[model samples]
Target: MKYITKNKKNNKQPRTAGEKKIKTMDPALLQVRPAMQESAGFEATLAFSDMPVHQLLKQNIQNKGYRYPTEIQERAIPALLKGADIIGIAATGTGKTGAFLIPFIEQLLHNKNRTGLVVVPTRELAQQVAEEFKALTTGMKFRAACFIGGTNVNADIARAGAKNHLIIATPGRLLDLVNRKALHLNAIEVLILDEFDRMLDMGFINDVTTIASLTRARRQTLLFSATINASQQTLIRQLVQDPLTINVSSGKSASSTVEQNVLEVAPNENKMEVLFNLLSGDSFEKVMLFAETKRTVDNINKQLARRGVRSDVIHGNKSQHYRTKAIQQFKTGHTRVLIATDVASRGLDVQNVTHVINYQLPQTMEAYIHRIGRTGRAGKKGIAYTFIN
Candidate 1:
């Protein structure tokens, strides 16, 4: 396989005396070449066949019934395995977690005492990543500690102080631990900023920058996001060094498999009535509803319950136990609807979400993409209905 090398002619000059000179590769120029398509109904070509994956991971992949890698996974796994810092841009539900986790765990298994830090924007994402890491590292000696807000800080400190191989955390809690001297980033060999655009949207830039400054300068960094903007590009330039940019999509934020539409409500019409009407229909088997604030999420969940809709709610104000329970109930099919704020937009990975309803549109287009992304996962057809008041 021929790889695209960084263009030396596009290198950017150093801005200051002590600043490191960086590459100026245009994101448009760095695209992942399309791989051979698989025959209809047969397992797709395995991109990892030629890569140096562990025998145990190979068995796990087979056991989990993974036949072919997603486009991002196909391109990213090999580059990450080769120890290249990468900036991966792919839509949600494109198997990004596996793309990064596989190579990360492989490196941990191959090297001794090497620690990896995966910083995400929300607690749900941190937990989801930790679960994926656990699934991949089953029967291995690696230990992962999940540090997020709302959990006991002392317990988190104990876990961080232990001999853990992986640290999956949100920025605020991780920075708190670091400030307390309970967790150190000096030993980190691998650093990943998953859903980084969301981190920027959530106003975590300062904390993320501080945490990155704490880590060793020579570590490998992998940054993944569905969309990259000018501010994000500035951060990428400051963080990663001559990174390989892999873009799988043609810059489409939302998934193509999702049928998106807007339900316009007249001036005098009640938006809740329209929502109730849609919920009464037979088209929805499982649904996710997004609102703009915690109070709005609670009100919607309450209104849905009063109107005989079995639903739950999650938000920043809820305790960790309540949020986890709500997610589990939604995932197990016990609830037909899960109403949430933008907090659920990023990394809530429930399966079979037949419909995603925007009771209110998100503040940013990126959040809308993530909210709709909850559905249409795993190549399944889904619908996204937005209520426009």
Candidate 2:
């Protein structure tokens, strides 16, 4: 029941689990070139001012200090604003949030009567999108109600039933409200599925399908994902109509801003020791550690706390309140390390995350990209290290 932790003062080595079964390494997975580099972008021909966005939205953009659009934003905004159903293929932190938000706000400004629904995969992402919406639509009389899990269902029902211009939600809670006749989607004009693939991965595709069907006649349908698989193509086709496909993702890699490498933990080597050494270094100011299961994430967080390290954890097992609080602590620098499973991998944006450590290998390269994508955001450089036993 003990974890291996290193004490540099004494060069102490602690006991760890027995040797794990060695799996064949995929060269393709190992060749994940960093794509977060500043130069690794599609050159934009138009600035924020040049786009046909509403003047107020434009001013709001300027107030936010957004001078130019990222490649995805630059290409996707115009189409989204033109009322085209869009499939925006872009990684997290590539300004994909703004890409759709700006144009959608503009459209709303032009016609306030139109209602919209933005469905995300996780509760954290639902909150992040809501905050971004609030920030971007400052001074505007836009009303949004967030219906995520981990809150009182009755309270959410009241809010969902109230008049709102937009409904930002997670699939489960939204469906619950819809089933209760608290939220009506028959008149929804815009439907946006952010982190589309993640939702599918979480087995929310059926729920998403139900939600999208309710808005079949919506004016616009926008789908955004870091990675898309062909198996989901049939479902995606059912979501959008005559959609303009836009892809700014750099194939498999996330960003050049992240320097990625792997570490080999010998049979007797404590992976915790390697992680501790990294965190003790000056470069890893704030770190996000990823494990494969809820138990592992909790174990690591508990061990770190035992060692007097400030860390917090979030996973599917945690309530929405705990997850939100954990993220808040990380944002306020109250926690040096935020440990979790792959739940935090998609659409969770925390600024200035200096490094990301994969305590164990992710099941797929896509998950690795998203995990590292948490760092190296907002044009900041980051480091990612994976432990291979």
Candidate 3:
């Protein structure tokens, strides 16, 4: 759980973690060379009116209605295209996906059948990124696959081997496939670690380290996080080469668009009743309620059903089919209330969610922010209420 960014120029100190096992490889296979020429300007300012990347890819970008680059995209994309190791620090919902996805897709388009590996913290995030990458590469006949938990392992391995150009996955499932000797990392030249901080927080350090070691040492490595503490910096240093750093202007606090409020109540005094009172209005439809445990989620769903409110519960213990159904009901308006635990916070990407209710406050402030982020997306106002006992 310790994240250390390898200082940009510092040498790695040898440490004993079991016996240090080293593998010898051909030196030629280990050298990762930049395929694209380096540029000095941001992609945002580049007058794409004439710059040639690929007429077809440029057309795809324009069709996506993206006329300008975000701060992270503006700074990071050029470096990424030049194949530099990069560490990007920016708040959530800042189009970090596009910053990497554009370059990733372009590489695939130009290089024909090359694979890029993207590692995330959770299954939802893996699916979300895969969807976004798929969208960007639309009309281009490149193949991509997602390898994450809650799915058949044999199915994923078969998909992974079928000439896919991109693999977006969570660390656990990716490492699982690696352990089974069902995945091939030999062809992957681009490796992106999105939400690098969350992976560190979720006890995925050892797994991520092992997965990263499988790639060519000189692969283009992109590390992104909301906040990069000292330890994460050290880890990045150890894992990547000299990485260009981009620090965007974060609001020095939680998301500015989200309206945060608190409600104090007794522990035994039906939190569901309090939730009903808060959600009594007609203006909110897409609502996400969070509790601290799977038992609490089930209890809340029961109370909501008793009150004639159609709701669904999602947690770790539920089958993947049930979890998917719960998410679908809330998303499609078949059921307006989605009850869940902290597990749904990081990676679910349903747009226009109007309210996020914390039936129970998270143990830490970071968890609180990520929970509320499920709503108020795509530049719309969202409300978050916390029930304190």
Candidate 4:
């Protein structure tokens, strides 16, 4: 084995090892270069500004203090407005929901009595989309409902019946609603699948296909995912027609905005110390922490409690009421920290989250992106910190 040697006082390694002894370099000879260009982080850009529909929609955005469109929003919104099927590949927090929602709302506003369907991978996301739709469509008469697990199915159906022109639902519950004859998809003109890749990863492909078949054949479809690689081609082909694919790199591994760092610690004891240090600082107002298992979620919550820090936990093992309560608490600022497995962290809709801490590294880089996305949502500046070893 041979090692490359560099001259003293200068850090550059010569192109050839023989060059080291050939020249006496000046003091100013050292020139350093990075392997890649330093990232300025992802910034939001407006893609649909001057269009008449967006100009009408811009008033709602400006009133909310959202001056710029995120990358996903910039790219996905125009295709949606053009009546083109969209396949959006963007990071978790790049305002994807709005990218699809704003145009859907505008279309619905133009054609009354026609409904839209948004299928999400999780209950949290279903609720989040419903809330965002409600917020953005304020003062408008359009009604929206959320059909997800844990809530009263009867109530969701009633809400759907009363005035819902748009419904955000999870696959299982939505299928259940369809089976019970409580909902009809034939009237739905717009169909959206948010976080479609996660739904496939969760084994919802069959359910999604079945649900899609229920809609009318001429319906407009929109699909959003963190990555739209070849693996998703079949699903993509089945749902969308001649789709306009927009790949905005917003996944966990690629986000330039988040300064990702991993902390090395012992198996269990050092975890709290790392968390406390990150949280005790006044700079971060909201933090989302991820664990690999539900048991870890409980244990970490207990640890935080003992440390006199108020935290909430949500996972598959928790009851629906508990999960909903935890989310509500976190959203209202009653709890600054929410601890859970990937279930709670992914597809969670909380804006202005300043930081995301991975108590454990996920199995893949994509999961890391989705977990961190909860913080840097809607083009807001945020950070993600991870713990390793």
Which pairs in model 2 have colliding backbones? 35-255, 35-256, 36-255, 36-256, 36-257, 37-256, 37-257
**Predicted structure with the largest TM-score when compared to the true one:** 2
Give the clashing residue pairs of candidate 1, or none. none
Candidate 1 per-residue C-alpha lDDT over 191-280 given as tens digits, one digit per residue, 9 for 90 to 100: 999998789877999988887888874479999987777667788888899999998754445776677776656555666766787899
Every candidate's lDDT: 0.80, 0.82, 0.73, 0.73
Task: List, residue by residue over 337-366, the lDDT tens digit for candidate 3.
Answer: 898987788778787788888776565555
Please give, for residues 228-279, the per-residue lDDT of candidate 2 as tens digits: 8778999989888778998777436567767777676655656676677678
Say which candidate scores most in lDDT: 2
* Candidate 4 wrong stretches, greater than 4 Å: 1-49, 54-56, 250-252, 266-269
List ranges where model 3 is wrong by over 4 Å: 1-53, 62-65, 249-252, 266-269
Worst 10 residues of 3 by lDDT: 1-10
Clashes of each: 0, 7, 14, 2
* RMSD from true fold, candidate 4: 11.1
TM-score, prediction 3: 0.82
Model 2 lDDT on a 0 to 1 scale: 0.82
